[model samples]
Every structure is written in C-alpha cells, then in structure tokens.
Target: MELHELESAWKTLDAQVAQQDVELKQLRTQNLRMRMRGKLMRASFGQWAQLGIGLLFALWGGSYWFDHLGTPHLVAYGLAVHAYGIALLATAVVMLLHLAAVDYAQPVADVQQRLLTLRRTRIRSERVCWIVGAVVWVPIMMIALRTIGLDAWLANPAWVLGNLAAAVAIAAAAAWVMWRRPAWFAKLSMDGPLAEVERQLADISELRA
Candidate 1:
C-alpha cells in the first residue's frame, strides 16, 4: 500500500473507534437511567400497595369498632385497638410519602443519598412499629385477663409467666429479623434496587477521578 493511503486508513479506523466509544458510553448511560427508573417504580409500587392495604384494614377495623360501640366483647381494650390501628395507618402513610419522594431523575450520587435516607427512615419506622406493638400488647393482655377473670389469672401464675415469656421471645425475634437478618424482604425490595444505582455512582466517581 502507498504511504498516503495507509495514513488515511489509519485515520478512518481511529475515528470509528472514537465514535464507538461515544456510542457505548451513551448506551451505558441510557441503560443506567432505565434501571434506576425501574427500581424507583418498584419501590413506589410496593409502598403504595402497603399503604392501600393498611388503610383499608384500619378503616375496616375502625368501622367495626364503631358499629359495636359499647359491646361487651370490645369493652376492655377497644380504645387500645383503635390506637394501634391508627398508629399502623400512620406508619404506612409515612412510608408511602417517603417513597414517593424518591426521585430517580437526579444524579446517581443524589439518588443514592436519597435511598440511604429512606433506609434510615424505614429503620426508624420499624422501631416505631415495635413500640406501638408493645403498647397494644398491654391492652391485649388486659382483655385476656378480663376474659379469664382476675381470679383465674391470679390462680395461673405459670400461664401468665409463659405468656410474658412468649411475648418477649416474639419481640426479640422481630428485632433480630429487622436488624440482623441479611435477607429481609424490606431490604430485598428497597435496598436491593439501589445496589445497581450505587454501582453506577461508584463508576461515575471513578470516571471523574
């Protein structure tokens, strides 16, 4: 081949390589955006479903309680039950609202920060649920005692102690699942989505560096 022809061919090859690099980068950016959007959508849908179910359950229970106002069956812990229901509904709404604010349009770092904030919020909400459960459990025990009669409850110290032990065990199990378990559903659904986003963010940081 002539020298001029060789030089022209090399220039063409370099230009093609540059073009492909640009196209590849563009494709990667598009893919990342799509993935983040999908993650946000899934998280939002899950939160919305939770909120809808919780709201329906709370309303249904509240209506039943109202309908049976002053009934003997609910007389002992009716107020407590209503309180617990309201607390549950409030937590669900808060979670839904927080998830709603999770915007994927932002930069990768911003999105990761938002997701981390959400994780913290979820942890706090779980703790709140535990506290509310304990609060409601007391009223439940009160109802149980009333139903069995105070005399019978006093006569069965072993049963009372057993029930207390069971409650403590259940609470401990829940705490373990929330804080220690590696494959919790909330982590899978919520944190799992952000894993890709975090990877992209790290990639971006490296590129910037």
Candidate 2:
C-alpha cells in the first residue's frame, strides 16, 4: 500500500508539471506574436549592454589601427596588423548580420526534439560555419605572429602576455557558462519540462482505469 501511495503521489505531481509546461509554451507563443507585431519589448539594459560592447571594440580596433599606421615594414608587421584589425572588423560585421537575419519572434516547438535527434547533424552545420571563418582568419593570426616574430619588442612582455591572458579568460568564461547554464547549449535532462508532461499522462491513465 505504501508503494501504491507513493506512485499515486508521483502521478499527481507529473500531471501538474505537464499543465505548467503547456501553459509556459502558450505564453511563449503569445510573446513571439507580440514581437512580430512590433509590440516586442526588450529590457533597456540589454540595448545599452550591446551598444557598450560594440563601442569598446570600436575604440580598441581604432587605437590598434592608428598606432601601427605608416610603419617602417609595410609588408611584414604592418600588413599583419592591418589584417588582424580587418579580422576584428569582419567578425563584428558577421555578428551584426547574424543578428539581423534571426527572426526570434518565431517560436518552434521542434527545437526541443531537434536538439535530441539531430545533435550531430546540427553540429556539422555549425562546424562548417566555424571552419569557413577559421579558414579565412586563422591564417591572418598566424601571419601576424610570424611577421611580429617571437623576439620583437611588442611581442615580448606586452602583446604576448595580453593575448595569453585574454585566451585564458575566454576559456574560463565559456566553462563557467556551460556549467551554470547547461540548458543554454544542450539539454541537461528531460526531467525538467518532459517529466511534467509524463505526470499528465499518468493522470489520464488513472481516469481510463
């Protein structure tokens, strides 16, 4: 009887979760519709955050570009610096283009299922984009490093140390986000939204008997 009672309680909990999931989905759709209808709202801070990052990169690239202007060795270090600067500009442009193309107002339920069934397939497409970007830009970084050479003045304590530190910080940030917000990239468990739907199924099962 204890086992049966425990099962009964679980079934009830499952049903409640399912109802909540359905409600959440409906609210999401309505929010999207509002967005597409030009009633979509973004937090004021989000806009400022985007603008601030863009402004910072702009200032950084500008300073980096201006500092290296009309250098003695145009083909060697100068060319590489220009190329690296261009890469930063290109990345910024691509990011903006991607932002422009995305229609976040459309809510697709299939996203959840797609994450499960097409992980490899989706990754292949994603990797292709990365590969193309790398093919174009990795050579630029390599050329820049080669041009500057390992023993150059700027390459010594300032530039090299800065690059390594930036790389480490990026890796740490990625790891932290992956751990704290696993669902942001991949589903951690079906227990979240799916389990509730299962409870609803259990309730229906009881009604049938």
Candidate 3:
C-alpha cells in the first residue's frame, strides 16, 4: 500500500476505536442508571407504605383524642400518640420529597450527593423515632387499656407513674448510647437502599474516572 493511503487507513481505524469506546461508556452508564432507577423505585415504594401507615396512625390517634377530650389523662395519652403519628407522617413526607428531588439526569456526583442527603435524613429520623418510641409506647399502652374499658392511670396511679419513669429512663439511656457511639449506629444505617445506591454511584464514578 502507498504510505499516504496506509496513514489514512490507520486514522480511520483509530476513529472507529474511539467511537466504540464512547458507545461502550454510554451503554455502561445507561445500565447503571437503570439499576439505580430500580433501587429508587423500591425505596419510593417503602416510603409510600410508611406514608400510608402514618396516615392510619394519625387517624386513629386523632379519633381517640377527640373521644377522650373530657378526660385529662386520657386526652394527654391520646395527644402524645397523635403527635407521634404526626412525626411519622412528617418523616415519610420528607423522605419522599428527597427521593423526588433526586434527578438521575444529573451528573453522578450530583445524584450521589442527593442520595447521601436522603440517607443522612433517613438515619437521623430513624434514630429519633427509635429513641422516642421507647417513651411513646407508654401512651400507646394507656390508650390500649382505655380501649378495653380500663382507666389504668386512675386504677393504679403508682403503676402508671412507674411505667412512665421506666420508659423515660430507657429512652434517656438509648439517647446517651447513640450520642456516645454514633459510629455504631452509623453502621446499622449503611444497609438500606439509599446506601446501596451510594455504593453503586461510587463504583460508577470510579469506573468513569
């Protein structure tokens, strides 16, 4: 072959190879995005389920509180439960909003940042709910007893007080533990879908780099 013709052929091959590389990267990115979409869908479903449950709790608590409006202790118990339900609803809403805010079309770094924010919010909310649940159960139990036609507080004020004290102690201890050893709880938070998404994002970023 002529030298000039040979050089032209070589340049054509190089261009083809570069095009294939671009196409391959695009394919890999698309596949990663599909996987990420599936993960986000699953996470969204979970949040929707939580939202439904929160709504149910709020409805029940609201009705209970309304019914016991004339009784101070029962009203207090009902209000506490109602507030817990509201908190749950709020958490669900916030999480769903964060999920919605995640734009897959953006760069991987941006998506990862949003996912991390969601994960952080989720972990903090879960911690709050776990600690508060310890004390919230007292009110729940009181409401349950009331449902069965028993005024627990009136029948055994000392018992009720004791239970309240124990719950407070438990909640306080849990809070202290979480505050002192945050890394322990952080490990626990690293298992969810958001964490998985973050991991995959890191891998994708590394591959692209």
Candidate 4:
C-alpha cells in the first residue's frame, strides 16, 4: 500500500475507536441514571407513605387534645401525643423536600452527595424518633385507656407515675447508648437502593478519573 493510504486507514480506525468509546460511556451513564431514578422513586414513595401516617397521627392527636381541654392530665397527655405527631410530620416534610431538591441532571458526585445527605437525615430522624418514642408511647397508651373509659391516671396516680418513670428511664438509657455508641442504632442497611446508587456513582467517578 502507498504511505498516504496507510496513514488514512490508521486515522479512520482511530476515529472509529474514539466514537465507540464515547457511545459506550453515554450508554453506561444513561443506564446508571435510569437505575438511580428508580431508586429515588422508591424512596419518594416511602416518604409519601410516611407523610400520610404523620398526617393521621397529627389529626388524631389534635382531636384528642381539643376534646380534653377541661382536664389537666388529659390535656397534658394529648399535648404530648400531638407534639410527637408534629415532629413526625415535620421530619417527613423535610425529607420530601430534600428528595425533591435532588437534580438528577447534575454530576454524579453532586447527586451522590445529595443522596448521602438525605440518607444521613433519614438516619438522624429515625434516631430522634426512637428516643422520643420510648417516652411518647406512654402518652399514647394513656390516651388509649382514656378512650376505653378507663382514666387510669385519675384512678391510680401511683401506677401512672410508675409507668411514666419507667418510660423516662428507658428513654434516658436509650439516649445514653446512642450518645456513647452511635452505630448501635443504625437501622438503615448499607445494602439498600441508596447504597446501590452510590456504587454506581463510584463506578462512574472511577471511569472519569
């Protein structure tokens, strides 16, 4: 073959290889994005479910508190329940907002950071609820008894106080454990969709590097 012809053929082969590489990268990115979107959709659905449950609790607590305005003990119990419901509602709303703020079109690193933030927020909220719930259930139980025509608090103040003390002790112990060994209450597993998305992002990052 002539020298010029040989050079032309090599150029053509290089261009083809470059084009294929570009196409492959694009395809991988698209696939990763689709999978990430699916994970986000599942997470969003879960947050929506949480929001619905929070709404129910808030309404129930609000009604109970409004009805027991005349009784101080009942009012206190209702208010405690109402506060917990509000906390749940607020946490769900904040999580939904964070999820909504995630822009999939952004760089993989950026998206991964946002998702990690969301995961941390979820974990923190769960921990807060765990500690609070230990005590919150006492009020919930009190309200339930009241609904069943048993004013347990008024009937046996000592029993009610004992139960309340136990709840406080339990909540205090849980808080101490969480403060000392933060990983013990790690409810969210690393094998979830979020983790999968993170792995995909890491792969993409490595490719770019």
Q: Give per-model TM-scores.
A: 0.62, 0.29, 0.90, 0.87
RMSD of each: 5.5, 13.1, 1.9, 2.3
User: For residues 24-120, could you state the per-residue lDDT of candidate 4 as single tens digits?
Assistant: 9888888888887888778778778878877887888888879978989888887887888888888888888887878879987788789788878
lDDT of 2 by residue, 115-186 (tens): 233333322323333333333233235335655664333445565446546655665665566567756544
> Which 10-residue span in candidate 2 carries the lowest summed lDDT?
36-45
Cα deviation of 206 in candidate 4 (Å)?
2.3
Q: Rate the local accuracy (lDDT) of all candidates.
A: 0.64, 0.43, 0.85, 0.81
Please report the candidate that would top lDDT against the real structure: 3
Inter-residue clash pairs, candidate 2: 14-199, 15-199, 15-200, 18-196
Better of 1 and 2 by lDDT: 1
Worst 10 residues of 4 by lDDT: 182-191
Check candidate 4 and list the clashing pairs: none
Off by over 4 Å in 3: 2-7
Once model 2 is optimally superposed onto the true structure by TM-score, how far is the C-alpha of residue 92 displaced, in angstroms? 1.4
Off-target runs (Cα >4 Å) in candidate 1 are 1-12, 64-76, 130-165, 176-209
